[model samples]
Target: MDWKLENIILGVTDVDRAKEFYTQSLGFHLDVDHQASDDFRVVQVTPVGSGCSVTFGVGLNGAEPGATKGLHLVVEDIEAAYAELEGRGVVSSGIQHFDVATGGMAPGVDPEHRDFMSYVYLNDPDGNSWHVQEAHHKGAEG
Candidate 1:
């Protein structure tokens, strides 16, 4: 059997607001937006080049808005990703590089651009957080 992760559910106070944030601010591709009834709706968006998408809607998520945390998005070029997001007018925690020797984090991308060492954090309008990490390996290495 093949097991593949597909979608994540995000709780949002307003569906249209969240949709605009994801589609316009964060640049995710809108996959679906369906309203089954006045109380039920579903909206899905996928990041560019990502196989997994995120869904948010009315009556679909029971968790509190902004409850989801620590979701990750990996990229080969940390600085480029940061620049693109910044250019899009998205607010972020700025790039931070992790020190393997002391496990300390400091501002700016890794000097050597090591995989999994550089990161930036972003939050949606509802404050659902996501970690963007520089990972050249792309999970090919064990």
Candidate 2:
């Protein structure tokens, strides 16, 4: 089956707030914003090179708009990407080493120690957690 993913819903408290965060902070491109009704609207955005887009609007089914921590996005170089993002003034937790028990590589083995890759955590405007990772075997497409 040739299935292409279209959108992933992102719950946000305010449409405008989420819009700005995706556009200005995460550098996602705004694809659509349409009012579905008097009380709701649909806004969609795509990361620069991602295959899928994220949508948000009023009263999305979930807790008030918030980011899910540890959502992983793979990159080629963790350190370089970290530096660039830091330069852009994005608050980062800095690159962290993870053990398999913490959802990393192997049990009791740190990714940083073995050089499998590196990772850093960041947040969107409303504290949605994001994990930026660089795999030693793959090159960054972004």
Candidate 3:
């Protein structure tokens, strides 16, 4: 047996605005936009190369808008990812890394380029925050 996460529900005040933010600004692929009536709607989007999709709409869930935090998106290179987001006009935090010695944080990518150390954060239009972390993996030497 296998378990998988297919979607995440986000409570948004404006469905179209959320859709646009994910699709246009964050470069997610629009998967679905269905409206059955005036009170109910569903808009789903998936980030590039991601199997999990984000769902937001009217009458979907009870979570408060902008309440979702610490959602993570992992990448191989934090600097490249940050640059790409900035080029797309998305406002994000400058790259920062965790200090293993002091258990604190410092500016810029991880000094040793360790995976899961470097990070940057950004928020959606509704203020749902996301953390982008570097998770690089080295290939086995032949």
Query: Which of the numbered candidates is closest to the native, going by highest lDDT?
Result: 1
The clash tally of candidate 1 reads: 0
User: What tens-digit string does per-residue lDDT give for candidate 1 at 11-114?
Assistant: 99999999999999889999999999998999999999999999999888556899999999988988889999999899999999898777899999787777
Across residues 1-142, which tens digit of lDDT does each residue of candidate 2 receive?
Answer: 8999867887677788879877876678999999979687888898878888888887456545564556677666666777777776778778775665657533221334334346677877776678876665343221
Clashing pairs in 3: none
- Which regions in candidate 3 have their CA more than 4 angstroms from the true location? 137-142
TM-score of 1: 0.92
Each candidate structure's count of clashing pairs: 0, 4, 0
List the pairs of residues colliding in candidate 2: 12-65, 13-65, 67-128, 76-140
The deviation in Å at residue 25 for candidate 2 is 1.1
Q: Over the full model, what C-alpha lDDT does candidate 1 score relative to the true structure?
A: 0.90
The 0-to-1 C-alpha lDDT of every candidate, in the order given, reads 0.90, 0.70, 0.87
Q: In model 2, which runs have C-alpha deviations exceeding 4 angstroms?
A: 99-116, 136-142
